[model samples]
Target: MIYIFLAVAFSVAVSVLLKVARSRGIDIVQAVATNYVVAALLAVLLLGATPEAAIEAKATWTPLVLLGVLLPAIFLVLARSVRSVGIVRTDVAQRLSLFVSLFAAFAFLGDTLTQAKALGIALALAAVLCVLWRPERGATERGGWAAPLAVLAGFGAIDICFKLVAQAGAPFASALLASFLIAMVLCWIAVLVRAATRAAPVTARSLGFGVLLGAANFANILFYVRGHQALPNSPALVFASMNVGVVVVGTLVGAFGFKERLAPVNWLGIALAIGAIGVMASS
Candidate 1:
């Protein structure tokens, strides 16, 4: 559908933007936090001045807020991971999201688990490691190995949150609000942690970057939330595939666009990523 393609395109653009913004000396975490703020404002606007719709959407708020809390911490880290590790492996970590989400769905939402999903998870984990692994002698050895792992854990939790929030059926915008508020809280906590540790004092640059990042990040998620309505399919497939698309795009970006080269062993991770997507699609 046109909406699906639009969703994919918007998402890709966001991914590319993250990569591009880093070169501008943007603080990835701050930028992401800003994006959430921008997105939250939009969500509030969409929720409208009336109280009725907002009240009815309380169910949606809970999950969205919970997601909001988790995402900033996870995605803020992801922004760093992407910069340190490159988009390819970052995307691979995202693919593993499906496996975590699948379990959450089965356990909490009572969704049926097929053998196809299990196989997909196994392949996805392999794919993630493959993408994250760099074979070079020195610097390449540590090229975001830990970052990808952290992203893997964060994004897995994110997948389930997305599913739960999707089911909430609030104005979608309400859910976005919850997400933003939570993310804001978590991000600020990080800032506090940095400050307490006597890291650099809050600079205008960090604040500005956080604001910009939040605005764009808000746009990024708003698109995802609106995508379900725009695309008529179940959000599950759409979300999963959107993640897969990110990997493909990130890999290409790293390899060709950014000139972030990888060894043959690492390329296998990309291949496995492709395979994992196939399994997800089929499942």
Candidate 2:
């Protein structure tokens, strides 16, 4: 439970850091690229992850590459989402993304769709729409849904790719390290391209923020893994607690700490999102 609490805290902290990055003049691209560097190093030092397993003939490069691409790309989308829609909605959308992978499981991975899972998926869909709704149409609301929706889809695809990698017999750490390295390279490429085009300048501030982001990001993964280890017989509890905790905590932070206003429908969406996770976990 403590591990789950830490994981939820770090998860929301990532969004908070991203939320504050732009106002601080942080170069998000450079920070994101640097984040992979830090994550890859931590993977090796803390997790003892090595590339040996990733190079095996049976290891699938397709999903690994997809993860590499999606991780950083979605990260950028996530930042944009936090900037546009605020953390409450963005976090709910992200947590609800399990439905995408859930549907994929039923359609492609041969997982049975139980009644509980079906109801959870339905609730998740309704939650997404509610969370994405903007009661007041204005300049700020225009195109706001795009980033959160992308966050939802992008994370769902990333989860599917992770499943594929696991199915290929690649150990979690090795797959994570490999994907981090690839994502690092891709992000650096984008950073360099932007620098060359004068779209954004790489700065020490951005690099510093990247280090913080990476630490939080890796901590989230580490604690979640530890939570599962700590409760080996209660994975569903850890899963549900982690997801529901993030939504609840993020909402509090966004609403009180940041004073972000939310409509009643948005609150309903948050409740539905929690309910969906609970239902799925029970199933």
Candidate 3:
């Protein structure tokens, strides 16, 4: 339970850091690059992962490379989503990515889809529609859905990649380290490309915020992974609780702390998201 709460807290803290980055006019690309580097270092120090071990794990590299490419791309998309749509919607969409993971479970992993899981997916789809539908502007708004949709799909793909990594039987810490290292290289390439194009000069402030962001991001993953390990037989509970906690807390913070306005349907979506998690967990 403490691990669950810590995961939730750190997850929310990530969104908060990105939100603050937007407020402070930080160069998010640079910050994200720095974040990967910091997270990789922390994984080495805290998780006791050796680069040599990761390098020798042949089965891990495919997912590790995919994750490396996807992590920064998704982080950029997440930052955009947080900035454009506020934390509540972004967080909801992010958690709803569980649908994709479940779909992958059924499609590629040979997991049987029970009725409850099917219904949960249906309800979650409805929740996404409701949450993203803008009031008084019809269903489609000007560029409103893009970031949220990207966040949804991006996170889902990431979840699938993690499942693949786990299936390979690599150590969690080493796998994470490998992914982070790859992500760092990819992000730095982007940073270098942008610097060459005069996008923005890298600054120390970005590095500072990135350290904070990296610590929180790694902590979130570490705690969530540890929590699941601690409750190996009750994965459903951990999944349901973690997602529910993030959605609920994100909505509250977005609404009250950030003064983001939500239509009634968005509130309904939040409720449905909670229900969907419960239903899926039961399955």
TM-score of 1: 0.77
User: Model 2, range 132-241, lDDT digits (tens) per residue?
Assistant: 88888642475767899999999999999989988988889999999999999999999999989999878899999999999999999999999999999999999999
- Candidate 1: tens digits of C-alpha lDDT, residues 1-283: 3444455555555556666665876656656656666666766685442323433665655656667677777766676777787766676776666677777787788888788887887887787666766766453566567777787777778767666656755444554565666777777677777668877356667677666555555555555656666666676666656666666766776678878878887888778877877787767
- Misplaced by over 4 Å in model 3 are 51-57
The segments of candidate 2 whose C-alpha lies over 4 angstroms from its true place after superposition are 138-142
- Colliding residue pairs in candidate 2: none
Tens digits of per-residue lDDT for model 3, 1-283: 8999999999998998888797797889889999988898888787788666665757777878999998999888989898888899999999999898999899999999899989999999999998888886678985679999999999999988888887877766877888888889888888889888888877889878888889899999889988998999999899899999999999999999999889999999999999999998888
* Candidate 2 TM-score to native: 0.96
What's the lDDT of the predicted structure labeled candidate 2? Answer: 0.92
Q: Which should have the higher lDDT, number 1 or number 2?
A: 2
TM-score of candidate 3 relative to the true fold: 0.94
For every model shown, the clashing-pair count is 11, 0, 0
TM-score of each: 0.77, 0.96, 0.94
Quote the lDDT for 177 in model 2.
Answer: 96
Model 3 lDDT vs. the true structure?
Answer: 0.89
TM-score winner, 1 or 2: 2
